[model samples]
Target: MENKLKFSQKHPLLFGFALILTAMVLIIGAMAVFNFFFFKAHRNSFFGTKVGVVHINGLIADSLRITNWIDELAKDNAIKGVIVRINSPGGVVGPSQEIYAALQALARKKKVVASMGSVAASGGYYIACAAHKIVANPGTLTASIGVKAKLTNMQGLMQKLGIAEQTVTSGKLKNAGTIFRPLTPEEKKYFQSLVNDMHDQFVQDVARGRHMDIEKVRALADGRAMTGRQAKEAGLVDELGGFNKSLDVLRLLTGIKGEISLVQGPPEKSSLLEKFLGKLTFKEQILGPRWVFTYE
Candidate 1:
């Protein structure tokens, strides 16, 4: 020890560099240990069965994260079931369908339950239909089964501002949904047909997911939002309850006498700019061009 102290005194700079390197190694090791335990706690338990949770919060603008969560839960043998907790008014059609599809695939491997929060309608309900069963609070707003595309005519505003612009397209319908002017009759019909087709697809998926007849679903798929109780009465929801009720149903489905641990995906990380803007810049609010159709 005296010789090491003498050596350190003779090479203080080298000793300081070695101390920093040792400190860094210790910190890295501590972080690794912490991450390991954290991941284990979230994914499984040493003494209980596990149930994974997939959160669908706010607008359903993107499916990659949600789908990846579902897929991870599906591959995890420790996860006997999954709960999809939804608190959204819905969003774009493509992402909603993707989430639904991912849930459906996961359902085949494990029991899946949908739990609706305050507002789970339109695309939210669409995704829930893919679950084995759905539970919603009686007062939850849900089941707005329809598609819509909003278009704005900026011609008058532009005229008032004395702004003029022109665009050239290969086809007459190429700019059918441009905000510069009102749509022509033909363009209107074309867009209407598109909306109708998407709406029909929504109804079909709902009917299939809920195991209800197509005609029965059509009766309730009028683009009007319904309360959870109303949806239950209309055969759109499997049960009328909240998150705990859904967990109970999951327990019943899994039939695990042992304790059940809930696992959830990692929280999403946001950039400093996104944090500053908050949800005002959520992807759902500004996802696409004027012609983009949505399940909102």
Candidate 2:
């Protein structure tokens, strides 16, 4: 008891400092936990005025998540406008079209602008058409308005390995894209017709969105990519500028003169273990089933 008393008397200030430090660490940890659970609901309330920013990065795949997010933002009255930041080379046909449709629906209700980064080609540009305005860097790769279908034949490799496979199907076209055999001339024609139809659909959407003649869009929709500056000249893009410039455009369109709050969609949730495994198997997941029509 005497020794304890002597130590406390000699180090009272140090003891108080340690106690305060420990309390601060605990407080910070508690706040982190609270924010993780309740931040979405509280964020808008914390910020007086804000524009919701939705990022459509990497390959444009499934649209359910993105569509749901846009719907949620549409219902939120606090979000004055929306900015869709796209950085992609494009992906599957169905998902890209779905995303474009969703964005078009959102545009009817609120002002939505598209900002391109790096490579936003093919279906990336397709979705951008749904926005009220599109902003891109001068050198940004913006337009590759077309579709592509690729099927790899593994018959040669299988024969080299002395392996053979057989399949049974109800219809001949059911196995149209099978890797074991090459496509017949008739099958090739069928696939070409399908691609041409999708191309026409893309052209119609672009013409409608940009208020351009269908013939003008059709002439340029020959699976050719161009710089953002070229796209602007062709009436495919609204402005040639970077992300910050896109925010400025949004500010002007919304008429918000003061400070603007930016709200972004929630980050994708994945476990550390899942992320590690995903890295190992990303290619297979991204390019599932070799025969797919893409806007890449």
Candidate 3:
């Protein structure tokens, strides 16, 4: 028999090109399947009357997600009102304030009600003030209005371990909160002033949101966590009840006679890499980073 080359051997270049194209298609299909399973968005009907629920769970590290949800609810016509369910101890000052501001803006367009859960203190209560009404469980802990900065001095540990860190700065206050050594008196005073200013901002915002006198808010803004009943007495909470109570309040406010459907935001989606490294926080990555002003 005469020797004959196979089709793939005769067309090596075309075979290679076909393999590459097949890989590309497979990759795209896999990506589509992954997105469908993990990153699909929540779908809400545009015609039905719905009430949006924004849950502020755990620490408020970043405001991007919550603020984006608020913006979406604001533009959605199907969402007649919103119930902000809070269950957090507190978090970073800047992010907390951003969430509060976003809620305030949303409250202007739609009826916003805050429903406090087991523990909604500090920054949690700060955001709740932006709502038109606040409902809390009788045993719920709320209102820890204060600013705090936590720093650690690692000088002794470094000295024992013979590890030294050399830092160059332009000014005396430039590297204020270095963990290499204890804070100087001047640094302490400066940090205290910053904390006071942030606390004042918190007090002023709470007063404005609750429609109470600044002094009254100042009196209660002593970093004291109070029960829902106590907060109601102090004019910080509007009502004492749980989620169902909040639903009735929203129903009454929006005049929704029939079944009130609760709409929540889509599940949080993170990249595959983020899922693996989400818990690792490198605090020393920043220069002279020791103090973190928070509402805890």
Candidate 4:
């Protein structure tokens, strides 16, 4: 009764190939699930005393935000400590304060540390002031305690191009920096007051953060950059050492024995992309030292 030469029985090789393909798909799927967990688990490191390096490696503009990164450190219980590594020229007033506030808030939950890079001046130091401790290299450039407002007077350019600007406002200061006209005395006084007030705030914040006298911080915060060793002398920083030394302090403070994880505002690999983009706009190129997220 030579009945059943079943289809799969007759062609075992085909069945074997199907089984192999199914096994491979399942394996790949399992790996993808594992990867998802791995990434999510590492995120906890940001909040722990895990020595996460927050790189502020650019201009100190009001728009360049760093608060979001700090917020991450705030929430991560494993991130018991933080190291804000800064290298910037100290940008405008408003943005720098935003970063300082984020650090201040984060400090409530965890100890924050500052690790200055090649440069940490003006707004960079402003951002660093919020940290409980500041570390820098012997040649680190830190300090730039002042406020600045850029005024581009394009009145002549507008006249040359025969461009006329029309405006009607309820307030006299509404069009203070309008490109069509030069600044008036009233406008000058108004803008100067704003800059001066921000400078005073900067000095006060520094003095309070470093536990130095307001007058002393005022003297050193003359919008001038300083070497790390010199900064240590002036009480701007606690010690003269690189990031490793900062990590040692972090380890002592938090007692975490894991590899340092760096969570920067923007990735360094994107720097080349920045250069190409920077050529198109002056605002885009300036490195800012400020907290980024409004509520990160």
Candidate 5:
């Protein structure tokens, strides 16, 4: 008994240290569990005030997901406003126009601010017009207000490689943009007409959103890109500033007082192999060789 008492007395500090460590571990574990459940449910609300932030990065191939996010934010009472951060050269005409339309709908309910990043040109800028205000850095590349259909003729390449492709289609226009052969003059005119019609639609949307004269917007919609500074001068952008500036504008427009919490959409998850290969690839993976009506 005396020997045991002596050992206990001598190691009292160690015993206390171990007890504290055990308590800390239990507390940390509890916190982890609580956070996992509670925060996941209340992810959209932070502290008290909440502002939804949607990031439009990379090539905009589709708008369904983003439009859904905007719709959710618009309906959420906690979400006061939305900030759309865009960094894209542009992508398919349909997707871009769809996103722009969704943003316009969202803006009708809540104040929407667009924050332009390094390369918000073409479809990127097209979508930005739907916002209540646009903020961009002075040096940011933007205002590629045009549409293009990229068609690649690989017939010579296939010939060199001793390859040939045969196709059966319902109509001549069905194979109009095929890469197997060069476009005939008639095909070229048909495609050009399609591009021109889409371009006119783009200009109309921009003019409607920016509240500018349609003719004015048309004058600047000649497939020419411009820097943010130039865009601001041309009245394409409302303000010349970065992300923070955009937030400030949104705060004022939304009448948000005190601290604010920004809730952004969850980033798309990618596999480990995809992440690894993406880093090594020189060019971005295209959906396919389909004719892309893009602003790039």
Candidate 6:
């Protein structure tokens, strides 16, 4: 009986130590996870103001996903302003301009700044021009002031490849750029007119946003690319600087500097452990990111 009693007493003590060790491990794990979170949040803010970072990193689309972020930022009083980091060539004509308009409307209420990454030209520039201020890094490539439509007539190839195409149309322009045959003169004229109209709207929007003359903007809208410095000279960008520099400008404009939150693209929804312990790695994720970005 005495031996059994001693064992029982020792068992509880051992159990207590084991429990304490387990708790320590858990606490350490949680601290590691959340420590980085605080660091990142604090690091992102400037002058005690939260600066939201929105990333436009792919082909712009018609989905509200992008516009919704902007709207959210506009409503959040915690976010003094935004810094849109753009890295894209361009995408569908309509979606690109739609996003630009949304940002312009947001700017009326709060400071909105743009930060051009490796490539913020074409439709990317379309959106950038809408911001209250624009910033580009030393090597940023921007300014593709143009619209392009590619129509493929695969009639010959389809026939050669044993594929066929047929069409019925209510209007003459309904089957305008049909791939089965070459574009007729009327069809060409119709497409050119559509493109020209869209181009005019683009030019006007850029001119109004950049505070530049319509004539000068029209002159530069010839479908060409320019470096960050060159774009500044042509009035395509407001300042030649990087991301933090852009934030400084936003701070100056908004007159608030503390913790800056961002209205950015959705994060890639995978955890670090999920990648490391699992089969995929960061490289695979990056390689696949473009597919997600393009929705293709």
True-structure RMSD, every candidate: 5.0, 6.6, 8.7, 7.5, 7.0, 7.2
Which sections of candidate 1 miss by over 4 Å?
A: 1-47, 270-288
lDDT of 4 by residue, 139-239 (tens): 98778677766666787898899998889999999878766777899998988887777788888999989999999988886677788998899999997
Cα lDDT computed for each candidate against the true fold: 0.88, 0.85, 0.86, 0.74, 0.86, 0.77
Task: Assess candidate 1 and give its lDDT.
Answer: 0.88
Per-model TM-score versus the true fold: 0.82, 0.81, 0.80, 0.72, 0.79, 0.76
lDDT per residue as tens, model 6, 54-82: 78876665435678787888788877788
Candidate 3 local distance difference test against the native: 0.86
lDDT for each residue of candidate 5 in 73-173, tens digit (9 for 90 to 100): 88898889999999998877878888898888899999999999998999999999999999999999998889888888999998999888888999888
Name every residue pair that clashes in candidate 5. none
lDDT of 1 by residue, 1-296 (tens): 99989989999999999999999999988877785677655434434678899999987766777888889899999898999999999998999999999999999999999999999999999999999999999999999999998888899999899987698999999889887788999999999999999999999999899999999899888899999999989988889888889989998998966566788773565687755554554543555567678898
lDDT for residue 282 in candidate 1, whole number 0-100: 54
- Candidates ranked by lDDT, best first? 1, 3, 5, 2, 6, 4
Return the TM-score for candidate 1, rounded to 2 decimals: 0.82
Best by lDDT: 1
**Pairs of residues clashing in candidate 1:** none
lDDT (C-alpha) at residue 125 in model 2: 93
Q: Lowest lDDT 10-mer window, candidate 4?
A: 287-296
Sort the candidates on TM-score, descending order: 1, 2, 3, 5, 6, 4
